[model samples]
Each structure stands twice: as structure tokens, then as C-alpha cells.
Target chain A: MDRLIEAIAATQNPSVVGLDPTEALVPAQVVASFADEIADEVEDAADRPAAQLAVAYFEYNRAIIDAIADIVPAVKPQIAMYEALGPAGVDAYTMTCEYAQSHGLYVIGDIKRGDIGSTAAAYAGHLGGVAFGAGESGPYDPWHEDAVTVNPYLGTDGITPFVEAATAADKDIFALVRTSNPSSSEIQELELAGGCRVYEHVADLVERWGQGTVGQHRYSRVGAVVGATHPEEGRALRARMPHTFFLVPGYGAQGGTARDVAGMFDDAGSGAIVNSSRGIIGAWRKTGAYSETMSAESALDLVADAARNAAIAMRDDLRAVMP
Target chain B: MDRLIEAIAATQNPSVVGLDPTEALVPAQVVASFADEIADEVEDAADRPAAQLAVAYFEYNRAIIDAIADIVPAVKPQIAMYEALGPAGVDAYTMTCEYAQSHGLYVIGDIKRGDIGSTAAAYAGHLGGVAFGAGESGPYDPWHEDAVTVNPYLGTDGITPFVEAATAADKDIFALVRTSNPSSSEIQELELAGGCRVYEHVADLVERWGQGTVGQHRYSRVGAVVGATHPEEGRALRARMPHTFFLVPGYGAQGGTARDVAGMFDDAGSGAIVNSSRGIIGAWRKTGAYSETMSAESALDLVADAARNAAIAMRDDLRAVMP
Candidate 1:
């Protein structure tokens, strides 16, 4: 994994694609490709709606993974999308994580889970590997994602469990310091005493939390999710916590260009993984690059090309400023 | 459901038992009773650790539900306990909800889910129901639950989607105005401008959001979750939002007694559901009623008696004070 980071650095690209498969946003060809197969399965298993959705989700994720694995250092799968489908959704999530891992891409489970005390511990256990009862068989092995996203609204008690579990599992956590959504300012930008903003306080906590999990790559195993849309804030947070990795969302479809995200990285592109979700997986459908006659495989090829191109473009933009 | 409220008023008891099945708290006898069966299942299905744990969880919930269903007006299943087991956990959760419903008890799905905008709508869809292709299946059938808990951090946008969904489905939502956890005061009690606390602001929002869903029982479908530990605050909130239902937690094991929770109810014993999870479910085990030779059925009987006694005692306590 350390070697993979160095490899990514060598390419001078810190772009990580997000696989947020919204049912409505899937390419027409992709939907058409699976329509008949899904119909057959649905007919056969009328009692299992969640299972049918899970199968579709897995196929969609596999397509995106195959498309973007070569260009992206990691693939962030939004757990909410999978969870929305229910247990089968979780099954799809696990399968997608496994698929991404097999393709040599880091899997960041975008689960913005927050709770107090022991409940948080349970969530961490679910994300990282839970010890099997000595000898257990089955494909539902505990997931060991490279990293996970967490919310810190409940303060220290909420985060401690995740930190403990991630440490034991040799994984990482990206705490929400500032989010990309417009409404995020309502809470994150609250003015505190002595002229410090709430997010600044959060940034300091991120630094403190990362102290124990410092990695050899000049970043900590504990990371902060600082949105690319807030470039000035992102730069300040980057400077505030020099040793912490940054998971920067709000790129592409969220109105953040590569140039806006450049300040989030270290001098050597060592500290950030910029995420673009809707921009990548739903790119073909958005851009209309594939016609109706195109095969789903061909459409996926174009989608992958768009994602790879986006990553390359981001890399070039960053290098133009940094170099 | 309205008639149920009327029955509670007639019975003069506002107590609702919460079925939070924490594994560690299960009695030794009950644990031993299921051990062999669970062990065999674990041996057969080693791959699905979640499924194995979920089987135990479902059995435990069934035991608890069967024990207390006759006495309690409702059973609040903490979604986190079920979620900890993964998809199988969700299956267990659905089964538990159905079981509770079948016993003529309301099932409050204690899932503190909150998101913004379209994502919020997606959560509502997932929780309520989604529009699948005609005659085709969708995730979580529309009529699965009577009510669900929601977090209110994102303000109006976060809650409106839930309100719309609940209105359409003829369901209800208990938004987190104040939580029972000790750490809840950290953020929830923050002093805002204009002489109103953050929670008051939340209460006001709850009042506004719930305006449309007022049932014949004179309570709105949207409710506030006010901790029984904060009696004065709960009373104030109740006064401010007269038509809103109040779901009071932090009773019993969390340290707030029946007297402390009494203020959350209206004069007629309406608009409140006081929850005692561990106090009800784990009562017999803690009270040493489960001896060495006590069978699972006997232990369950003891549990039922304890819960029924507690509810009766609570009713007496409330009745003694009411004019």
C-alpha cells in the first residue's frame, strides 16, 4: 500500500474516483444491458427485492471499477447507496469493495456514521475485520477497507472507537472537517470564541486524532475530509494539519475544478485523495458520449475513458501550478 | 393507532417498553439455551458471521417481544443493534418489527438517519417505499413500519423529506430534538441568540414541520424525542409544541425514572411514549429471577411479569399525581 502511494506520487496524480451509483443516473445502455437479466431475476425471486437490487448494484460497481481502476488510486463507495437497498445492498457493497481490492485499488467506505460510545465501536467493527469465531467459513468475511469516512458531531467519544478499530485493522479514518454541501456552512462555520470558527476547532481535533497514526508517507493514518469547493479553507486546513491525509470531495460535478483542489496536496502530492463521484460513474450518461446502438461494454469503455481523462487532466493542472 | 392512544389515556399509563437487545446483557440461562443451536448454525454457515449473530438476535428479540407485548403499547427496536449484524441484521430487524406489529403493538424503528435534499428523499424512500416499475418489487415494502426515528442536524431540508414521506405513507417520525446520552448536551444545548437554546429552535422546527400531519388524536405525525433526564426542558418543549408527540428516552437504565418522564405526557396521558429498554428486557436477569434450572420459557415468563409490573407501577405513579 505504501508502495502504491509512491507509485501514485510518481505519476503526480492524487485523484480518486467515487462510485456513487444512483439508480436514476445510470447510463441508459447499462440499464438496458441488465434490464432483461434483472427482469428474469425479479420474476424468479419476487420475494427478494433487496437481493435483486443488490445484484444490479454489484454489476454497476463492477463496470465502474473496471473502467476507472487504472486511473484512480482509490475508489470511494458511498455506503448510503448500498445501504438504501437494504441487506442485499450491504452484500453489494462488500462485493464491490472486494472487486476494487482485487483490481489493486484502495477502497474507502464512505459511511458517514456517527454515534456515541460503544455503538461507534460496533460500526468500526463492521467496517474493519471482525474476528471470526476461531474457524468460520463464508464469503461474508468482515470488510477491511483502506479507509472510512466518519462524522464527528458527537465529539471524542464518537471517534475514539473508530480510531481504536482502524488502528488494530491497520486502516484509516477521514473525519468530516468541512463538507461540500451548501448547508454545511450553517454548522461548520459557526463562530466560536476568540475568533476561531467551528471548523477550525474541528481541524485542530483532526490533527490531535492523527497524532498516534502517523504514516511513513508524511501523512497520518487518520485523515480529514476537506472539500475542494472551499479552496481557501482547504489550504488553511492542509497547513494546519501537515501530517494528515485529506479526502477532498466536491470535485467535477460539485463545481470544483482540479485547480481549486491543488492546494489540498503536499509539495509532492503526498497528502490528498481528491474524489469525484457523480462525475465518473455517471459521466457517459451525463455527457451523452455513447449512442443508443452502443453496447453496454462499449459505453463503459467510454465512461472509463472519461474518468481516466479527468484524472489525467487534474494531474496536469496540479503539475502546471506545482512544478 | 389513534384508538391505541385512547387506550393509553384510559389506562392512564404513558410507558412504552424499548426492546434494545444488547447481547452481553442476555441471561446465562437464555444464552445457554440458544448456545447449542447457534453453535450448530455457526458450524454450518461459517461464512455468514452476521447471519449467525442475527439468528441469535432474532431469537432474543422474539423472546423479549413475546414476554412484554401484552403490557406495552409499543416496542422500540434500536436499529443499531440490528444493523451491527449487517444485512442479516436488517432481516432480523424487519422480522422483529413484523412480530411486534402482529402482536398488536406499534414498532418504532429507532434509526437516527438524516441527510439533506434529494439524499434525504432517498432515505425516506428507503424507509417508507420507493416507486419501482409497475408490479415489480422495491426495497422495503411501504407498510413495514408505523414510525421511525430521525436525526435533525441538517434543519428543515433534512426533516421535510421525512414529513412528506410520512404524510404519504400515513406513518410518523420522531426527530431528535434532544437525545438521552450524557454527551447530547454538548451540541444540543448550545445557547443561541434571541434567548432560545438550540433545542428550542429544533422544537420550533418540529412544530412547523409537523403542522400538516395532525391526526384525529390531536397529535401531529411528526414528533420530538426529548430526553426524560432533562425534565424541565422536556416540559418546556411540551408546552411550546402542544400538538407534537414526545418520545422520551433516558428512563430506567439510563437513570431517569418514571416520575422524571411524567411531564412529557399531556394531561390526558396522550402525546408521549416513555421508553425503558434495558430496564424491561434485562430485568429478570439482573434481579436474579433466572435460577440454574429455569428454562428459557420460564425466564421469559419472569421477564414478562417484571415488565408488566413495571408498566403497572408506572401507571400507578402517574395516576397518583394527575388531577
Candidate 2:
């Protein structure tokens, strides 16, 4: 938690770019380059497209990471996007994590994994530690993140192992609280006994879970994923979880503006890090920054620059609204 | 849901072995055979143990699947154990799912994945469907599964995509309701304003989510993961969600006995399936079935028979109490 806060302080931007790549976003030239590389695999002709696209996805992530590593404090790679492509896609995710970290960016694995006790322990091991022998822990995984997002539906039993592992390794986790989706109100906004929403109850638990491990910044290793889209809930949760850092998703393309997310932070503007995926990576498509007269190759060459500028613009927008 | 129930009837067993392999469970002889296979990987000396164990873990899972494929209706491969090994581990997971289904066994991916809308759709695609260009759907992943376990923390938005995809593909989902872990009570058992537990609230949403897609057996494709350890809650939930199938975990090793899990089933003992991992795969260690006089190779050779017998014993135990 301290390391993440320090990174945000050093960068003067509590913003993390989300690396949720899709085939539609990958450059045509990059996909064509990897075509032959996937031809020799022992799969049917039908399976070759996803295999080739997986390699291209990694190359595309590398380009984005290299472009934005200096500006953003972190990069959150959503695991589902990579897992959709199969094992090779997982390989791409691993490589992307390694590349981003090598470029001095903290990585938050957006893998919302939750399970029962023993299985949760295994997941904790996958995130930060690996159990080699009884009562003996091996070294932490290099490919695993400094932090990871987790689902809290199975309750504290599902989350305890992760909390223990992160405390031991000085890593961290962000538990899903009030999410950014439209139908999230189906369960999250439900009225509890005293008019407290379900998300409030979850936030209370997250705050209590972090009480044992408060960091120097008055925050704890246990954080909350309070969607930036819900500014009212964000304000309430921020006050409720004074010591919990927030990983605020739902910015830009998800309809969360900088002003809407401002409430996620403390008065010092230091407690939350906002995430934007398509808004930055797909900025060229939305902004039409590249001229229509440019060839596809020329537009592809300028994408990295456009993404870098989009990230800078986001940082400025956030800074303007935050205290 | 109908397919699962029919398979259980055909096999006369509502139990599924969980392929949650860990390094300690893999016999030493199995690890030795795979040491050479991992020798060329670009890993440090510290990583070799896990890499070798990953291959051995796959070998161990294959043996277990082969042992019980004829007796059990299905097998649930918990993704965490395989994910602990990195990309290679995911490869082993994919192979295990494929192998189990090819042996005429239904495979349930115990991946408690949940996220916001767009990301959740990607996960749904990973489970059973994939979106290609406009109006086109790619080939379903054979390495995927007949069903998957999902965490419901992000509310209805996170779960809707999975339900839609599963219904369209004739697959199903098990939403985490009352999990088997001890600390699950921390949040799931919390009493809401109307005196319903948080998990009950989630169950209500899960039931409503599948309203448009009930199967032929008078049950919805959406299911609930009710822990066997909580018999009282299980009974209550069964009465409340009569049309929802149940996937009960926490048998044997988690201290959930056959009688305790009986409430999860219908009067005909047909609506639920139980999962046991270490209790089945590590039976040799518990029962002392492999003679101490045998060589490591001989003991490894006998593991499959031990596992087969253990699975049969579990099935019989459950049948004795179910009806």
C-alpha cells in the first residue's frame, strides 16, 4: 500500500491505465506479422486465428506500456480479456505484466477470483506466494502483481487468505464494493435494515479487514473498488472507509468523468487511483486525432503518441477536479 | 440443468470429484518424470520446482479423471490450483477439462470469476462462447466447460452475461450463495432489513436472473453453490429455490459429511451434486492403501485404484443419506 501511494505521489497522478485489449483494437499490421508464427501449432485451421491474435495482443500491450509507463503510476491488465484467448492468451497476460513492471510501472491484475478456504489459499499463492512444502512458503511470483482485484461475494472466508498473503508480502488487494455497471443496483442498491445499501455493508467489512495493517499514509493494504460512476456512493464510501485506498474504475468510456470521480479521494487527493481502459487505448477512434488522409501504417505509427497524450489529458482532468 | 440431472440419474451418483491438484499431492516419481520436460524453460533455479510440479500435477489430474470417469457424473476442476503455476498451469487446466469431457464426463470450471459488464462478457465468452466479427460467433472452446462457478459480488450486471451465454449454449452456471468456508458467515450470513441474509438476497437475484431460461426439468440453467457444511441454510435455500440446481462443496476434507449434505438434494435426490477434492485425490495418504513396502513407482501406479475406490465410497455414502 505504501509503495503504491508513493508511486502515485512521485508521478503526481493517481491514475492507472487499464490494459483491456481486444482484437478489434489491435493493429492490422501487427496481426498479420504474427500469422505465420501461429501456423505451425498443432491445432485445426479454425483455431489458428485466436492463436495469432494472442501474440498480436501481447505486442500491442507492449506498445501501450512502453508509451505510458512514464506517466501512469500503474497498469491494470484485466485477466478476462487475455483468458478468452486460451493458454496462449494467458501467456500474453504474463508477458504483459512482466513488461509493464520492467518499465517501472506497478501492475494490478484485474482477476476477480474468489473461492472457498483451501481454494482461496491456492489463489493467494497464485497472486503473491506459492506453497512448496508444508509450513514452508516459496519465493513470490515474479509475474504476479503488486496488487490484484478480488470479488468479495463468498464473504470474508474467501478473502482472508488473500489478506494474509498480501500482508506477509507487502502486496495488496482491492475488493469489489459498489461496481460501475448499470444493473449493479439490482443487488448493491438494495435497501438493508437501516436503509444502508448492500455496498455500504461491504464497505464496512473492507474497512474492518484493513484495521490490522494500516500503512504510513493512513491507508491499509486492503482497498475498495468503488466505481467512479457513482459519485454519491463514492463519497459515502470514502468517508466510511477512511483508511482504505480506492481503485476507482468506470472512467471515460464507462461514463465516469473526472469530476464524478473526485469524491473517491480524500481531501489530500491521495487515497484513490482512477482507471480508464478504452478511453485511453481507443482514444484515436473516439478523438479522430489522426488525419483521414493518413495511410493505415501512418495512423498505426501515431497511436502510441495519441495514447500518451490521452493519458496526459486524463491526468490533467483529474488533477483539476481533485483537491 | 436438465443435462446435469440426467447424467446424475444415469450414473446413479450426484457426486463430482474436484481436480484441485497441489504439488504435495503429486507423487515424487511423477515429478521426476517431468523434470526433463521443464529443463529448457527460461526460468531461474527457484522456479524449476513449480514448473516440474505443474507437469506432475497434470499427470496427477489425468490419473484421477481416468479413475473416476465411469462412476461420477462430472468433475469440477478448480482453476486456482492450475493458475498457481502461471501460464503452464492454465494449459494443464485446459487439458484437464478437455480430457474429462472426452471421457464422457461433464466438466465444471470452478472459476469464481466476476467483473463489470464489458469484462464480464469477455469471461462469458471464455466459458462457452466467443464473439467474432459482426453477426458471427466463433467455435466454442472445447477446452472450456459444460458449466462454470461464478462469484456474484458485482450484482446482476456481472452475472447476466454468463447466464445469457450459458442459456444460449445449453450450458449453466453455479452462483456462489452460501459457500462452505467457515468465515463465509462474515458477510453472506448478515441479516438485511427484511431479515433475509445477504446470500439469500443474492439467491433471489440469481433466481430472477434465469427466469427467462428455465430448463426442461422444471429448473433454471442458473444454479447455486450451497455449502454442505451449512445444512440448515441449505435446507432453507432448497425450499426457497426449488427450481435452481445446487452444486454443494465442502464434503469430507472440509468436514461436510454425507448426512449434512443431504438437504441440498430434492426428495428424489436429484437436484444437487457434491464435490470433494483432497479427500478423493489424496485418499492414498488418508487410507494407508498403498503399502509402505512398495517402491515410489509402485505406489504411483496404485494411486488411480485408490482414487477410484475413494470416489465410489463417497458416492455410496451420499446415496445412503440422500433419500
Candidate 3:
């Protein structure tokens, strides 16, 4: 959290680009460019298309990362988008995270993974890394992610392993508190007999989960994901969980404006980072600069430029609403 | 649900083997056996260990699947275990699922994935498969799963896509209701203001989510995961979510006995499929027949034999408790 805070301060931007790629989000020509090479490399004809698309996704993400590296402090690569393509897509996800990190940007893997104690420990390997060959030589990090989003439905034991892994690796974990989607209210807004809503209880647990691991910035290794759409709740949560940072999503394409997320920040303007996925990555689609006849290189160039512009606009949008 | 129910009836075993492999669970000699081949295949020395382990996990799972194919109706490969090793492990997970399905066993991927509407649709691709090149000739099924486990914290929208995918693909999804872990009580057992517990509300949701998708077995595509650890509560839920099939985890290694899970079954013994992970897959280690000096092939033979015997024992144990 300290590292992310400082990176935000250095960039003077509190936004993370969501590197969530889809077939529609990525340029079609770029996917086409790899068909021949993939068809040659991949044995099965059924697999070649996904393999090609996976390669195209990496290229698309790489272009965006390079475009916004200096402006954005972090990038959130949603794993579901990659996992949609199976193993090949998963490779692109790790490659995207590694590429983002190599460019001095923090990578927040939006996996939303949760299970019981022992299983959570395995998932925590995203932070704890892996040791193969004998124990003496190495614990190679396959997923170069700084923080990952976790689901807290299984409670404390499910989260403890991630907290431990984050603490050990000087990384962080953000538990999903209140998501931005329409049906999020179904469970998160349920009022408990204790009077607090379920998400509020989760907010308190998230604060406690980060207790002993507060960094120099006064935020802990555990963070909370408070959707930008819930301004009042996000504002209240900002006060309720003082030690926890917030990863605010649902801005831009999801229809959350700067004013909606403004209250999620602290008085010092440092407690939260807003994420805009399709908004930034898919900016080229809205720019009207894309042409179907364009070469793969030219389309990527357009994607990169459009993303950089969108990221800068978002930065200014947040700055205008900052305390 | 019909496929799974029929498979269970055919084998007379309402049990799914959990193919969750860890370094300790896998025979060391088996992993060591892949060292030379992986060293030649993988360029980086740091990656050799996980790559080797990933290959070993596939082989280990193949043996278990082969040995238990005749006795067990399904296999639930917990994705987190494969995820611990990164992309290579993801490949193994898909491979394991593919192999198990090829062997005439229903493959239940214990992914527990959940997200917002669009994102959840992407995760649903685990059941729906992916269309790469032109969407014309191939919606290639990369993940050969008959069903997948999902988390229910995000409510209806997060679940609807999986339900839709399952309905379209003739597959199924089991949402987490009352998890097996001790800490699951924190949120799940919270008494809501509505007189029922939070999990009960979720149980109702699970039942309703499957309304229009009922199968020939009198169950629906959307199922519930009620832990074997909670007998009385699970018994209550068995009555609660009648149309929702149950994927009951925590059977053996988690202190859940056949007697404990007996109440989770329907009157006809058709509603639930229990899972055993380390209890069966790691049974080879507990067998006095295992030795550090045994060859990798011999260790795998022992693993196959132990897994088959364990599967038979579990079947008999559960049968003894059935109505």
C-alpha cells in the first residue's frame, strides 16, 4: 500500500488503467495478423483462433502499457477476461502483468478468487510465488502482480493466507466490499441483525485484516474495493476503514463520474485509486480513428495513443474533483 | 444435472474425486522424473521447477482419473491448486479436465469464479467455450468441464451468466452457499434482519436462479455447495433448495464423515455429489507401501491403486448411510 501510495504521488495520478481485453475491445486486424503464425504454431485447428487472440491480447495490452506507463501508477488486469480463453488466455494475463510491472507500474490482478484456508494459500501463490526444483534454489514468481482482488465470502481463514503472503512479499490484497454492478445489492446490502449491512461488516473485517501491517503511508497491506457508483457508502466506508485503501471501479464506461468517487479519497487525497477498464483500453473504439482496413501496427498505434489520451483525461478529471 | 445424476446412478456412487495436487501431495520421484525433460523444454532455470511440477500434476491426475473412472461419476479439480504454479499449472488443470471427460467421467471444475454481468459472462466461458478466428467453424471447447463451482457473494447478476452458460451448454454450476471452513460462519451464519440467516437467503437465491432450467433428474443447472461439515444446516438446506443439486465438499480430509453428509442427500439419494480431495489423491502417501526409493512409474502405480481403493471405500461408506 505504501509503494502504491508513493507511486500515485509520484505520478500525481490516482487512477489505474484496467487492461481488460476482449475480442471487441482489441482491434480485429491485430487478431487477424497472428492467424497465419498461430495456425503454424498451434497443432489443433480448433485451438489456433484462441491462441491467435491470446497473442493479440498480449500485444494490445503491451501497447496500452507502453502508452500509459508514465501517467498511470498501476494497471488492473481482470483474470476472468483471460480465463475466458482458457490456458492460452491465462498466459496472456501473466504476460500482461509482467509487462506492466516491468514498466514500473503496479499490477493489480482482478481475480476475485476465494476458497477455504488451504486452497486460499494456493491462490495466494500469486503473491507468495512458487519454488520448484529443490527448496534451496528458488521461489519463482509466475504472476508478477502487486495486489490481487479477493472475494471474502469464506471469511477470515480464507483471507489470512493472502494477508500473510502480501505481508511477506511487501504486496497487498483488496477484498471486494461493495461492487458497482446492479445486482451487487442482493447480498452486499443485506442488513444484519447487528444493524450494519453485510458490506459494512466486510469493511470492518477488511480494516481488521490489515491491522498489524500498516505501511509508512498509514494504509495496510489489505485494501477494500468500494465501487465508485456507491458514493455515499464509499464515503462512509472511507471513514469507517481509515487504515484501508480503496480500489474504486465503475468509473467512465460504467457511468461513474469524478464527483461520485471524490468522497472515497482521504482529506490528504491519497486513500483511493479509481480504475477504468473498457473506458481506457477501449477508447480507440470510441475515438472514430479506427479503420478496418488499417494494418495491425497502425491499429495498435491508434490504441496506444487513444489510451494515453483517455488516461490523461481521467487523471485531470480526478484532479478537478480532488480535495 | 441430468448427466451427473445418470452418471451417479450408473456407478452407484454419488462421489466426485477432487484432483487437487500440491508438491507434498505429488510423489517427489514423479516430479523429479520430469526434471530432465522439462529442463530441455523450458529455457529459464527459474521456471523449471513449476513446469516440472505442472507436468507431474497432469500425470498424477491422469492416473487417478484412470483408476477411478469406473467407480467415480465425476472429478472436481480445484483450480486453485493448479493456479498456484501459474500458467503452466492452468494448462495442467485444463488437461486434467479434458482427460477426465474423455474417460466418460463428468468433470466439475472447482473454480469458484464470480464477477459482474459482463465479466461473469467471460468466466462462464469455462462452460461455454471460446470462439477465436471467425466464430464460424469453431467455438472450440478448451475447458472440457461438465460443471463449475461459483461464488454467490455478488448476488443474482454475478450468477445469472453462469446459469445462462450452463443452460446453453447443457452443463451445470454450483454456487457456494454454506462453505465447509470454520471461518465461513463469520458472514454466512450472520442472522439477517429478515428472520433467516444470510446463507438461507442465498439458498433461496440459488433455488430461484435455476427456476427455468430444471433437468430430467428433477434438479436444475444451478446447484448449491453445502459443506459436509454442517450436517443439520445442510439437512435444512436439502429441504430448502430442492431443485438445486448439491456439490458437497469437505467430505473426508476436512473431518466430514459419510454419516455427517448423509442428511445432505435427498430421499432418493439423487440430489448431492460429495467430494474427497487429499483423502483420496494423497492416499498413496498414507499407504505403508510407498517408499522414497520407489521409481516414478511404481509410485504412480501405487497412487492409482490407492486412489481406486479409496474411491471404493468412500462409495461403500456413503452407501451404508443412504436411505
**Candidate topping DockQ:** 3
Candidate 1, residue A196: Cα displacement in angstroms equals 3.7
TM-score of chain A of 1: 0.88
Against the reference, the lDDT scores of all candidates come to: 0.71, 0.83, 0.92
Off by over 4 Å in 3: A133-138, B133-138
Error of 2 at B289 (Å): 3.9
In model 1, the clashing pairs are: A137-B46, A137-B47, A138-B47
Question: Candidate 1 lDDT, tens digit per residue, B163-216?
Answer: 887777667888888777776675566555445566777788788888967889
What DockQ would candidate 3 receive versus the native complex?
A: 0.74
Winner of 1 and 3 under DockQ: 3
Which residue runs does candidate 1 get wrong by more than 4 Å?
A1-12, A28-50, A129-141, A193-195, A218-221, A242-244, A266-268, A287-306, A314-323, B1-12, B27-49, B133-143, B192-197, B291-323
* lDDT accuracy of residue A187 in candidate 3: 94
> How would the docking of model 2 be graded?
medium
Instruction: Give the interface RMSD values of the models in order.
Output: 3.4, 3.3, 1.7
TM-score, first chain, each model = 0.88, 0.93, 0.98
Cα lDDT tens digits, model 2, B79-157, are 8998787776788889889888889898899988888877888888756577541123455473569999888877787
Number of the predicted model whose TM-score against the real structure is largest: 3
Residue-level lDDT of model 2, residues A28-64, one tens digit each, is: 6667776676887636665677778788788778878
Order of quality (TM-score) = 3, 2, 1
Residue A193 error for model 1, in Å?
A: 5.5
Clashes of each: 3, 1, 0
DockQ of all candidate complexes = 0.32, 0.55, 0.74
